[model samples]
Target: MALRTFLLLLLLLAAALLITQAQGIGSSASDCCLKHSQKAIPSGVVTSYRLQGPESGCLLDAVVFTTKRNRKICASPTDGTIQKLMQHLDKKAKNDKNKKKGQTQRPRGRAKKQRRQQV
Candidate 1:
């Protein structure tokens, strides 16, 4: 009876771990857009955004924008203006990430000294 109980518990734990891992596998690409919004987000007020493709299970390709008011808005990805803005934001994000990587690769004290010397 003790051995049977232990085996059952082990099986349950294995199943749980497998389910958890499977859920995480494609979670980062999952749909995150809300179904409703109280008001429209103004043009050029997006602070950040992410593009979600059909593979992410959204009904359509979506541009999930984070507005200056900190509200999230979902817009049609087919819009040309949205597409351009998404591309611009993507480039800006990449540049910012590269700058951070470069900064981190240098020692802080050395960076400060170099900046002081240049000035």
Candidate 2:
């Protein structure tokens, strides 16, 4: 009876380990796309996107677009519409970044005090 109980415990432990390992794998792939979407995605709804491949831990090459609501849609990279949309998004991002950099930076601390003294 003692030996049987030990064996049962060991088996249970192995099962637990397997389940945890499987869950770990699933979590790692949680952001991965299992398949690509065939339906046309409205460009207006896309807020951002990213590319995925086998090296990126995905089984297929895909351009994953993030919708305004933060939903991810995987699309084929070779699609002309997808490519155009990616370019548009890229340009928008670049423009946004440039706009941020163009913002006026005021003098701080000693600089501000020196400017006040000068005036």
Candidate 3:
């Protein structure tokens, strides 16, 4: 009986380890998994993200995002939604680029106006 119990415990442990590793918990996904990772959404493409992990895992409560930005910028499982963050960043980047271009180009504010309206 003792031997059988010991063997069972060993088997259980191995199974647990196998499960953890198979889920990519401590590997490359770990950097982005429970810890949060980002990628640029790129122009003309919608970004999508979701956390992957066990039910009791850190990502169980994670909120997925559908936005544009090829990478993850900042994330907090409790604070903000990922979609809002990406949209905010995309807006900021677009504004910044427009400002820079405006400074470079002739004061044809008319063209800038058109771009803003289209956006």
Candidate 4:
């Protein structure tokens, strides 16, 4: 009975270790982003962008952009143009989120229509 109990405990320990390792591998894979390049891309060519901070595990802060050529580029955070673009994108995303939230919170009934009609 003691031998059987020991084997069961060992099996559970092995399963826990495997689960931990799997989670680590999955998180690390997701944490990685496109590697940064040194070549400069013209401001007019970038179509959209999002900022990734240091908490994202990247070597440095990066601005990931989609270009008119259908390419994704990672630019340096230190660049003034990239910084301004990121701020604009951040504000736009915030406004869009708030608009969606407001729409969802409205009552879906004749009462809402009546209230709107009164105003």
Candidate 5:
């Protein structure tokens, strides 16, 4: 009789825990917001965006753009919308550097008749 009573008690405890966990999940599904964007994407109106999952949540740290046609684009910004714009500008700089590197320029000093092998 004592063994049966102990087993019943354990079952009740497990049921209670399961009920509480279900309620918690329901509340989170309704309350949590993820991947929020702003109407005026160019004016820098949006704030923070994050991705929520079963294990953890992480901040996007960028500006997300939405067009009238409902197209989505992600812009890089470590902090805010302006920062994302800065990131784009930095990318332009890198591209310019790459273009300059690829161009053929006259050598200042005596050079080999053959061009160096490119990797």
Candidate 6:
């Protein structure tokens, strides 16, 4: 009976620890964008973007565009210009990925060829 009681207490302790960790994770994320920008940003400067919403731990819905210089700019999700930019970025990313996949073999340098000939 004593061993059974000890085992029950251990289980309860484990349950409590799991609950605490789960709650900690809920508030661990930092808010990215405070508000959306009204000014139009050029698609040429934007490299990529990510959608931010309340579900992602943010207060407002936004399109967070990352520029070529590594700057994050927030824009309204409903904006038509922003949507076009997102589509452009998506296509550019797909093309870039395809180009990388096509390059299967790399040409060896002259130094490497000379080393093999000497051996």
TM-score list, all predictions: 0.48, 0.65, 0.29, 0.47, 0.35, 0.63
Per-residue lDDT tens digits for candidate 5, residues 1-119, read 99999999999999998998777654444433345444335534332333344433334444444444555545543447546555565575688889898677765778768878999
What TM-score would candidate 1 get against the native?
0.48
lDDT for each residue of candidate 6 in 27-111, tens digit (9 for 90 to 100):
6246568888888898888888998887877787888999889999999989888888898889999999998987886755665
Clashing pairs in 2: none
What local lDDT score does residue 77 receive in model 2, on the 0 to 100 scale? Answer: 96
- Judged by lDDT relative to the true structure, which candidate is superior, 1 or 5? 1
Which candidate's lDDT is highest? Answer: 2
Which of candidates 4 and 6 is the stronger one according to lDDT?
A: 6
* Local distance difference test, each candidate: 0.73, 0.87, 0.56, 0.74, 0.55, 0.84
* TM-score, cand. 3: 0.29
Off by over 4 Å in 2: 1-27, 105-119
Q: What is the number of backbone collisions in each predicted candidate, taken in the order shown?
A: 0, 0, 10, 0, 0, 0
Q: Can you list the residue pairs that collide in candidate 4? A: none
For 1-119, candidate 1 gives per-residue lDDT tens digits of 99999999999999998998778665654546654343555557877987676566555567789888887788877777677778877887899999988986746564433445554
* lDDT string, candidate 4, 1-119, tens digits: 99999999999999998998777764533644566777866766776786677666555567778888888888887887767877776776799889888896856667633445564
Better of 2 and 5 by TM-score: 2
Candidate 1 CA-lDDT value? 0.73
Which structure is stronger by lDDT: 2 or 5? 2
The list of candidate 4 runs beyond 4 A from truth reads 2-24, 28-35, 87-119
Over 4 Å off, model 6: 1-29, 105-119
**Higher-lDDT candidate of 3 and 6:** 6
Candidates ranked by TM-score: 2, 6, 1, 4, 5, 3
| Reference-based lDDT, residue 34, model 1 | 51
Give the range of the ten consecutive residues with the poorest summed lDDT in model 4.
Answer: 25-34
